[model samples]
Target: MFTLFRKEINGYLSSLVAYITIGVFLLVMGLFLWVFPESSILDYGYATMEGLFNTAPYIFMFMIPALTMRTLSEEQKDGTFELLATRPLTDWQIVWGKYFACLLIVLLALLPTLIYYYAVYKLGATEGNIDTGAVIGSYIGLFLLGGAFVAIGLFASSVTKNQIIAFAIGVFLCFFTFIGFDSLSQLLSFRTIDSFIASLGINEHYQSVSRGVLDTRDLVYFLSFIGAFLVVTKTVLGGRKW
Candidate 1:
């Protein structure tokens, strides 16, 4: 498992995927936070990071798919997945190794965003006037969100040998888990249980955490959400034999 994890990390670095992923994420986030007037923090005249937290998930919907699209699909397509299976590693080890490698890539992409936080922290009417609690909570929520998305993407890749197909499936699944339930809950037909339905999606818990309150329920939801997808991914990966 460790060897596979290291190989996956090395594969991403040698292929420049990690650098490009980080660069593209920062570029798009910078534009939304600075250049785009509508979403720009400068135009808000406040020391808040509402735009960053709100905008990141949508960007991640696309960006994370692009990053994880090849994690397993490329291996399957190139006939390397067979090599991986013949090794001593178990199915769970393979799934986790790939999952962690992809998650670390996402963490690298998010690290530089702290500069934005610091800038907002200083740009306030008073230095460090920002909502420190909220900022920290939002960051935590975003990381959990990324972890869930990576699991979803890995599952998507596991079921397909084509990277493009994997990406499409990943994006759709991410959208469905993240916001599709919330949208479905808003339907007139579902009005009676709308709130309950909304609770099934990631956005509800994500927003709750973003509000600077770390509810154990929200933490449990994220953990369960991520774990469910990863377990399913392992199931899918193991199913290749039968």
Candidate 2:
């Protein structure tokens, strides 16, 4: 597992993918928090915390796909995938190895945001009276949200050898999963079913957890989503030799 993990990590770092992913994430966050006139830029009396949380999901929508686009696609495209498959590694090991490499990049991108938190801390009227709990909660939600996106992206990459196609499918699928159910809920004629549909979306659970209220159901939903997608990715890769 460590060997597979190191290989994937090296693959990402040796190429432009890791740098681009981190650069885009920071650029988007900086623009929203410091440049956009309507929100963080004008100091409209709203906390940066809100701006950060609100803009993060959309930034992640693009960044995660970029990070995962070449994970499996490049391997298959270059014919190195079969070599790895025939090695001693199991499907699960490869899946998790790649997953952790992407996850590490995501986490590294997130680490710089601590500066924002510190900036907010010093900028507060009082000495750190800001709602740190909610900020921490939102960060947790973002991590889980990114994890699920990575899983979906891994699955998408496994389905095709074209990196561009993998990226397109991964982005659309992530966006759909994030808001599709909520949109469906709005269009439903029956009120009871509408609420159920809304509840099924990632946004609903994400919002709940972001508020510093860690509901078990929301946690379960994220875990289940990640697990389900990872399993599917494993299955897809497993059938490569068949």
Candidate 3:
């Protein structure tokens, strides 16, 4: 598993895909967080990084799929997937190895954005007017959200050999998982059912976490979501053997 993990990471770094993925994520985020006149800090009239936290998940919904689309899909297309399955590593190991690689790249893309946080911190009228705990919680929420997206993308890739199809499916699944439930909850009239429906989606938990309320249930939700997708991905791969 470790070997597979390293190989996957090395493969990403050895190609332009890693740089391109990171570049795109940072560029899109940077544009909203700093460059764009309207959303930029200069016009926001505040020293908070809320724009980034609010906007990044939307960008990542598409960006993550692009990163993971080729993980298994390209291998299956090139007939390498069959050869890989014959290795000592189990299906879950392989799925996790690729999942971490994609997640790592996305996280690295997020690293540079810390400068924005620093800029916000310093740009504050009082040199520290920002809600430090909220910002920290939001960052943690974003990371978990990214992880969930990566797992979903990997599942999409596992189901198809066509990268474009994988990306489309992944994006659809990610977007639906992120917002579909929330929308459904709004349309329903029952208060209990409404909250339950909303809780099933990513946005509610993300919002909860982003508010600095570190609820264990939210963490469990993310972990369970990731685990469920990975298990499904492994099942998808297993089916190819039969």
Candidate 4:
């Protein structure tokens, strides 16, 4: 597992993929937090990172899929997976190895955004006026949320050999998982179970955690959701016997 992990990480770092992914993510974030009028901190005139927190998940919904689209898809397409699978690695190792590598890239992408936080921290009328707890909680929520999307993206990649198709599948699945259930809860037909239905989606748990509450229920939901998708990805890899 560690070998596969290192290899995958090296693959990303050795190429332009890691740098490009981080650059694009940070670029879009910079645009939203600084350049864009509506979400720009300059326009808000507050130390709060509500703009960053509120819009990050949506950015992640697309960014992660683009990163993971080639994880398994490229391997499968290039016939490299056959050789890798022939080695002693288990399917879980392969899945996790690639998963963590992609996740590391995501974290690296997020690392630069701390500049925005610091800028906001000092930009306020009072130094450090920003809500530290909420910022920390939102960062945690974003990490877990990104993890869930990585798992979903891996599953999407596992199901196909075409990177474009994998990317599309990943984005669609992430969007639906993040917001579809919440939307479904509003339907008149599901009024009785609306809350319960909403609770099933990432948005509900994500919103709960973003409030700086650190609820165990929300944490469990993210972990369970990630685990379930990774397992499904392993199953998909297992099914491809050769």
Q: How accurate locally, in lDDT, is each candidate?
A: 0.92, 0.89, 0.92, 0.91
Residues 59-169, candidate 4, lDDT per residue (tens digit)? 999899999999999999999999998899899889989999888888888888998898888878989998899889899999999999999999999999999999999
lDDT of 3 by residue, 59-144 (tens): 99999999999999999999988788888989888988898888899889888888888888998888988999998999999999
Q: What's model 3's TM-score?
A: 0.97
**Count of residue pairs whose backbone atoms collide, per candidate:** 0, 0, 0, 0
Q: Deviation in angstroms for 115 in model 2?
A: 0.3
Residue-level lDDT of model 1, residues 1-242, one tens digit each, is 88988999999999888999899999999999988999998999888888999999998999999999999999889998898898899999999899999999999999999999988888888898889999999999999999989989999998999999999999999999999999989884756699899999999999999999999999999889889988998888887862
Which residue window of length 10 is worst by lDDT in model 3? 37-46
Candidate 2 structure quality by residue, lDDT tens digits, 30-67: 88887787658338564447888888998888899988
Tell me how far candidate 3 lies from the true structure as C-alpha RMSD in angstroms.
1.1
Segments of candidate 2 deviating more than 4 angstroms: none
Flag regions of model 3 displaced more than 4 Å: none
| Deviation from truth (RMSD, Å), model 1 | 1.3
The local lDDT score (0 to 100) that residue 74 gets in candidate 4 is 91
Which stretches of candidate 4 lie above 4 Å from their native place?
A: 189-192
Tell me which of candidates 3 and 4 scores higher on lDDT. Answer: 3
